[model samples]
Target: MSMWIRIDDGVATLALTPPADRAVFRTALIEARGAMLSWDVASGQRFPDAEIHSPLEASAWLAEIYGEEIAAAVRAAAATSLPVPGSAELVDAAHRLAWLMWASDWWPAGVYTPALNGPILAAETAVAAHAVEHLLDDEDAVERTLHQAVDAPSALAAVPLRLRADAAALLDVLTGLADDHGIALSAATVSTSSADWALAAGARGQIREGIEIGHGLAPVRWADVPAQTVAADSDARWSLRHIDGVPHLHVSVAAVPVAAVPSTEAPGTEAPGAEAELWARFGPESLDIDIPLQGDSVGFTGNMQVAASIALLPLEERTLWIRDPLLAAVPGPAESEDDRDAVRAQASIRLDDPDASLAERAAAE
Candidate 1:
C-alpha cells in the first residue's frame, strides 16, 4: 500500500508494497522510477514517501523485500554503474516521465504516428519484462522465457488464465506495431482492448498472413488502412509506391474531404452489402458518401486529385478496407495535414483492383 524512495548516504533505494496483481505491480514499478527520479536530495529534505539510508542498509532491505531484480538496480546505482542524475538530469527525466504518461493514454486510441508507436510499445515491453524477471527471481532464465513467449505466444497458454490473457494482450499490441511499420517481429502481442476497438472502428483482419488482434488475428496491412480517405483540393499532389508487391497511391491534400450529405440508401428497402454491413454496425447515425477525384484542371497531365472522402464521416460510420491504398500507407494523427495527404494518397483504391491493371491504364494514357 505504501510506495516511496529513500536515499541513505549517496545511495538511492526504491520501496513499494508489491501488489499481487501483475498489471498493478508493473505500474507500481514505473511509478516508483518516476518518484525516485524526482526526489530532492538537497537541504536534507525528503518527499512524503521518500527516505534516506546508508548504502549497505538500503541494498539489504531492498534485496529482502523486493527480490533480486530491484535489488540489482539498487546495487548497480550504489556502485555508480547506473546512471545517477544530478539536478539537471532530474528535470529532464521528469519531462520524459510526463510525456510517457500522456502517451500511454493517447496511443491506445490510435492517436499516434506509426513512426512513434513502435518505439513506445517496444520500450514498454522491455520494462514489463524487467518487472516479470524480478518477480520470478530467475533473472536470465525468466528473461529468455519472455523472449521465447514472443515467438511462441501460446507458450503462455499454460500460465494462469489472467496472466495468459495479459501476456496475450501485451504481445498483440507489440505485434500490431511491428506489422504496421514493416518491422521484423518475432514473439509479441498487443492489448485486446485496442484490437477489439479497432474492429469496432471499421477495421478488419487478414488472419492467415497477419498478427493477433484479439481472439482473432488481422493482417499487418490493417495498420495502414485508414477509416476513410480525403483529397485536399485542386493543388493536391500524388505519388505511387509498392509495398510487398502492392502498389499504393500517395496523395497530397489540396482540398480536404467533406462530410457526407446523408445516405440515400433508406432502411428496410434492400439488404446492405459488405460496405453497408460495415456502416450498419455503427447504428443509424452514419452517412455514406462516394465522391470521385477527377484529374487536375491546372495542367492537362498533372497528377490526379483522388480522394475517397469516407474519412470525413464519424469514425464508427467510416469503414476501413484492406485494398485501400490508405490501408497500406502508414497512418498519421487525425490532425496531421501534410502527412494526412500523403496517407490519403497512399489510400488510393482506384488502381488497387486487379481487373483494372495500372500497366494497362498507363499504356492507354
Candidate 2:
C-alpha cells in the first residue's frame, strides 16, 4: 500500500507496504528484486566511502517481498565472521552478502554507504579490496580493454554480483592451475555464459595473453589452453609476432563466423539437410578457438567455419543474416608497409568487395 525511500547517515533505507492485489504486489516485488540485484553489482565496484552507508534497512525491505527467511539469510551473511584475505570462500561470501543486500533493496542507490558502525564498513572494504586486487592483478583485463585500439569490437556490461561470485570461484580454480604450470597471471576475466576467460602472465616486459576455453558448455582451465582461432575467413587474418623476443601470434579478425554444429551423421554420410538448415545455427558468444592454420591447434580442430562459408552455400530461400560480432585479437604493431598491406588485405575479406584477396596483394608486392 505504501513505498518509501529514505537516506540517513549515508545509508539509504527503503520500506514498502504490500498491496492488496496479489498480482500487483508480485509485480512490485519483481521490480524491487531486479533493483536489488542491480544495486549489488554496482555497489561491489567501489568500497563504501564517505558517501555510502550500509543498507541498514535491508532486512526489513526484504521481509516485505521475500518474507523473513531471505531477510534472515542476508543478516546472517552480514554477521558471519569475515574471512582472511586471499580466502576464496570468504571473498565469495562477502560479495554474495553485499549483493544480497543490494538485491534485497537494502543498499540504496547501488552503493554501500559508510555507517557509524566500524565492523560493517570493514567487512565491505575487505570484499571490495579482494575483488579490486584480483582485477588489478589481471593484466588481460587491461589488454581486453586495449584491444579497442586495434579496432577489435568489444562490449562492456554491468556485471551482476552472482556473476562476480562465479568469477571469483573460477579464479580460485585457475590460480591452482597457474601455479602448477608456472603460469603467473597478472590479470584475467571469467565469463560464465561463455565458460571461458582471457588471462595474462609473464613479467611486465614479457607479458603474454592466453585464453582458457570450455568445451561445449563445460568450464575451461589452464590445462585446456593453447587458445587459437579455429574457424576463420580471409578477413580474420593472423600473423606471427615476437614480443620482447618471445614468439606469439598476432591475430586480427574484423568479424568471426558462428561455428557449425558438429553433425552426428556417420562419416561419409550426407545428412539430409539444406544449406539453409546449416547456416541458421549461431556460434557461442565466446568460442574456444584452436586456429585451423595458425599456431598449434591443441584445443580445437576441424573446419566448422559456419559464419564465413554460410554465404557461399546454395539456398532456396533468401534470409537476412546480420550480426555485430565483436572485433577480436592481439595483433602487434605492423613492421612495414608490406606487412601493413598484408594485414589490410586480409582484414578486408569481410568487406563486400569481390576483388578482396591476400594472394592478389602478395603478387602485386
TM-score of each: 0.20, 0.17
**lDDT to native, each model:** 0.28, 0.25
Model 2 whole-model lDDT (C-alpha atoms): 0.25
lDDT of 2 by residue, 68-184 (tens): 443343444332222122222222433333432231222111001110111122223233333333322232432332221111001001122323443344335444534544444
Best by lDDT: 1
- Writing each residue's lDDT as its tens digit, candidate 1 over 109-179 gives 12122111223223334334443222222335323323423433322222233344444555565455445
Residue 206: error of model 1 in Å? Answer: 24
The number of clashing residue pairs in model 1 is 34
TM-score of predicted structure 1? 0.20
